[model samples]
Target: MRKHTGKSVSRRLVLKAAAVGGTALAMPAIVSRSVLASSGEINIMMWSDYLPDPFRDAFTKKTGIKINFTGIGSNDDILNKMKATNGQGFDLISPTLNRSLLWEPLGLIQPFDMKKIPIDKVNPAMAKMGETVWNFGGKGVAWVPHIWGTEGVSWRTDKFKPAGEFPSYGDIWDDANAGKTMGRGHSVMLGAGLALERKGEMAPGSMWAAYQSPEKMTEVWSKLTEYCIGKKKNLKLLWNDADTQKNGLLNEGVIVAQTWDGPPIALKTAGEPVMYRAPVEGAMAWVDGLALPVGVKNVDQVYAFIEACYDAALAGEAIKTHGYNSPVTGADKFAGDVYAKNFADAYPGDALAKLNPWPPEAPWYAEKRTEFVNKFMSA
Candidate 1:
């Protein structure tokens, strides 16, 4: 057997290894952890608001494990940073529940020993991923839900009001909002597909079936991309992160957008006329959680961190900080009436059941989707 003499965990090398019979899975032995152990800090790549100073301080005070935190705005940021480093440096990542299954196959993440993490403390509804998508070959679960949220419509009530109880995703693409609307590129395409689905344009269940095969994915997404491109003239900006989403609505002359549940909700609480809700087409829901990276030096500290995150009180307190919901059971009780009211307002009626979950991505699906996303962005 020829040995991999180099120290780098670059994506090229890992994927190359995986192509030749899953040699990529043997990551624990390839990367040295002596360098990581000397630092003695748990390197975490997670959402910016997820690790507020108080949360970090409390966790550090309790476990004596300091966090070397790197904040990310999107899941793509998580993928990019990890790819740039070949999955090295960071001990933990928070891939979305739907995206978690792709990591182990790429040899980027290790699985969780379920017994070590407090999975039982998490809400059964949110924790189900640990038994399905996150589970790798029935051996170990790769990711666990920490915080969960939806992607839907947000609009400046004073600036614009569509004629509906719950505005449809179609409103964002309408000529009335042209040059005054915005959305994240690849994602809004998904929203547009849902809109098409509801309108009897795209086949029902086709969007979810995109994950089943390469042809199905391209067939579904290509139509969505075309529809989005036709409406491209209507967009004021394409936001990539939460800050950009808020800024576009508040300052960039954007009145309506398809957005994550967090930013617009926070703005509303702060007395902005902004409001976010489940669109008539349905909001896209997803879970973001901690996933261990391969070649972790501080495995014990990683497990400790996971255990601390399962604390319901702390998780609930984080709701106001990020404007997103917690997956920890009983978290809402600690979040107060305001959080309760906000959640109610966002999903008024059967919208919760109508949430279109982001399905797990197959590697080829990701590869081919990028081609369309780039085409739409440049178009």
Candidate 2:
């Protein structure tokens, strides 16, 4: 064997190295305290609103470790960056459920040290999702549950009313609601497809799932595509994120569109007559979390960061700031009257109980993204 000495290598080599290195499982080497101190920050790759000012400020005030927040792009962008970096010089990443499966298998991320961040501290439902999803189909550890929420239909009570007491997923395809409705670009179709399948109908996971198949995923996709195309005349907009969907319903009067719980909760709190319903067939729920990458330099600091996030007060701040329910135990107590009042006044009875579990691990989504996107999402 020849000694290897190169400052840079090809990207393909980086990926191959990660796979060969078991996703950079073991740390390369610990840098000296002086070297780490000279670098002066804990780098983070996460979603927007993940680490709000209060959480960031509280952490910095407690420890002098500055946060160099980067990677605010799409999930693919962040995962590709982590893959390219080969587990070096980053502390944490909070990828969605789908991305975790890919990263963990390649050993791009490290197994979460439960002792450093006790798994019991998180919400039980979220904890279960994390255990199954991040734990690599029961063998590997990759992503952890950072945030979780459901995708469902949201409607403006101020503008319209359907014929029935409760709205169903099939309401989107109804002609009576025509031109007053919207589905979330392709996510609407995918989520609806999931809802349909959970209720014994078939549609692909994404509109693109039509091209790739176990046949089931494509069956779901095709149904959703037909539903959307048929209802295209009824749509006002195809939404992407929570805020846009909320504003579209509130300001634009797009009465019914697929959305998560956060916006409807916020709008209702602000005295808007908005409602997020968990259709009889159930809704699609998602869970995300924090994990140390393979190359993270400061294990101690990374552990501290995880613990800080799990802290009840910090977790409460994250909940208030981000609007997702916290995974941290006892965060409800720290939630204060604002959270309590809003939460209590927000949903209908059994709303929390009605929200269902999202499928834990799905490898095919990332492995087949191009096919899924092309068939379903593309206009």
Candidate 3:
């Protein structure tokens, strides 16, 4: 059986590589924990293969705080699980930066206790992005930046050759690649759809408007739905999980697919002739981070888990095992020479400047996108 790794790439390097900067302030006070029974464990809801096993084991050994992981496949899955449990099942939740914003309005998450987190050790650029973007008008922080990466095309290097530079998201529509390509069945698909719109491959409009206005969302989804239906026959699969996508590429003869940067890197390291591309339109950039769910029972253990994530040694293992870059400063020192070189080559800093980061979308927008996706898949 083949092993499949999960999503995320480093946003810290991308921020530095792009030379972007902004100011941010730390959390003023730690939320007072209400008395509750000690569980001696920190429950984390995150994507599969996100936290390396070695790191989890080491964290437990070092701190005596057991890490209970509930692996999820997508951001929507995270939200669904949280809703099902009324945000009570987990202490720490990981969601993409944009999804984290939605949790605040839903009353599902609470602000981090800055005193417990090593805020000074986090990447300043990421801190700024979180404060300015995810923090709902500076009211309070509900999300803390952790790991990030780009969403782009991954192809079998042994099978397909780009004419020159890497192709655009429109490549998924190529007739010749029919029955050999796959697309993710999630809102990130909207990122690629919007990129196609930008390149004039689909109807033109403000992609952001789809997230803000019902009329505009209908307009965008109408175009997106039509475009997807046209190419549906070309797709070998519509994947909902990383392992399925990884196995499709490795053993099922899939030639190209939309993917997070991690899978291809893992495949390449394993000697598969695969490559992840930065499409001409732009890679869909994303940041997934830690958030405290409301009514968490083990508050101190939660802080221990957060600090363990930032431990340079553990951060290094995450990069080596998961193909993601840690947002914690100096974690790269532990990523080792070979993986570091591979990461530098795979995601050059200048190329990162071309990445289009995922922004917060309205709940209605997400609802409409899911509706269209279900329809497209069933069709």
Cα miss at 314, model 2 (Å)?
Answer: 2.6
Most TM-score-accurate candidate:
3
lDDT of 3 by residue, 1-379 (tens): 1111111244444755422310121111232232122236888888786876777766565556688898887888888888888888888888887665466578777777776677677777777666666576566777777786677878898898765466556666678888888878754357557668767776654565676788888887787788778778888877776787789899887888888888777777677898877776667777788888886988888877776676666666677777766777776776666566556555544556676666666677778778888888888
> Could you tell me which 10 consecutive residues in candidate 3 have the lowest summed lDDT?
19-28
Please list the residue runs of candidate 1 whose C-alpha ends up more than 4 Å from where it truly belongs after superposition: 1-40
Best by lDDT: 1
Ranking by lDDT: 1, 3, 2
- For candidate 3, the lDDT comes to 0.70
TM-score of each: 0.85, 0.73, 0.85
Task: Give the alpha carbon lDDT tens digit for every residue of 63-94 in model 2.
Answer: 66788887452466577787787877678887
- lDDT (C-alpha, whole model) for all candidates: 0.75, 0.59, 0.70
The true-versus-predicted C-alpha distance at residue 338 of model 2, in Å, is: 4.4
Residue 107 alpha-carbon offset, candidate 3, angstroms: 1.0
